[model samples]
Target: MRSLLSKVAVGLVFVFGGGLWAASAVADDVAHKVVIQVSTDDERTQKIALNNAVNIQKSLGVDEVKIEIVAYGPGLGLMTTAGKQSQRVADLVLQDITFSACNNTIKKITKKKGAAPKLVEGVGIVDSGAVRIIELQQQGYAYIRP
Candidate 1:
């Protein structure tokens, strides 16, 4: 009788634990994630990157997808308040897309220009753009450069 009770308890634990694990896996599978890298200041490249993000969101549905754009070096210009694409950036931000600027780039630009460039409202600053991209990739986000 004791042996039978022990076996039953073990089975119950496995059943419950397996259910929890399966639920977690399904949750992760339902959301698609992508990280886009922008290292150039070229307007065309920035536009292409933004377009890619928009297309992904439209195809996957905003609630089912996560998109992040990482800007470093000269590409940080795209995230600046005074950037040529500031209006577009702001519009995208309203749609739940994330824009990240590199702190290292901001510091360098500040040192050279005597002031830090202001990022568009709602933009986040990461310690390093490349590092952030790598971390996101490690977390299962697809990487893109356009």
Candidate 2:
């Protein structure tokens, strides 16, 4: 049987080790690269997402941040020239953040709704946002949906 002092020492060691592990698990990154994914059809949600991305950059003090807003469905409106968020979207583009639309989604939208709006110059068209997300994950980028 161990003495009370030994048991207390072991408990403290366990607690401190667990705390260190937890801290290491979070990307409290001094300088790290991130690739966040954004896909939402709602305007309010899109605004919130944009805010979240900005907040993360500010909070983490990331050195190289590459946020990719992958728009699909009605979310494409957030990246279009005629869309209400054009000016605000431009703000992100200036920050080196990319805004891309799902080409597959555009095809479906055009086939079903008969109107295929084009994305702005700053906004690119990817084959599929889902595939992009998987590729990013495989590349070891932390996945955040805001």
Candidate 3:
């Protein structure tokens, strides 16, 4: 009877422990995550990055991937409400692609222009664009610069 009870207890541990391990593995397995960095103010570069993001989503399926675009320096201009590409940015946001603007850049621009630039709706502000890219890379996100 003692041997039988021990065997049952061991089986229970294996069943529960295996279940926990499987759950943890599933949680850690992300399909794909990409962080695209844009530091130049060139409209061509900005448009290329945006096209790359759309292509990635189309190739991988929107639900199978995550994408973030971090803009700083002159690139932050792309996120401004008055930017020529603001409408395109807004459209991309609706598709689950995220856009981040550097707060440091905003401060510098504000100091020079005497006012903070208006950001399009849904644009996130981060303390630093480069740092944000680093953090995302550390979290296993793939990095791209166009």
Clashes of each: 0, 0, 0
- List, residue by residue over 12-77, the lDDT tens digit for candidate 2: 999999899788756443334455565666778888778877777777654556566677766777
1 against 3, candidate with superior TM-score: 1
Per-prediction TM-score to the true structure, in the order listed: 0.87, 0.69, 0.84
**lDDT comparing candidate 1 with the true structure:** 0.96
Q: What is the C-alpha lDDT of each candidate?
A: 0.96, 0.74, 0.94
Best by TM-score: 1
After TM-score superposition, what is the CA distance of residue 50 in candidate 1 from its true location, in Å?
A: 0.3
List the candidate 3 regions with Cα displacement exceeding 4 Å.
1-30
Output the lDDT of residue 2, model 2. Answer: 70
Candidate 3 residues 36-101, lDDT tens each? 999999999999999999999999999888899999999998899998899999999999999999
- As a whole number from 0 to 100, the lDDT of residue 36 in candidate 3 is 97
Worst 10 residues of 3 by lDDT: 24-33
Candidate 2 displacement at residue 34 in angstroms: 3.1
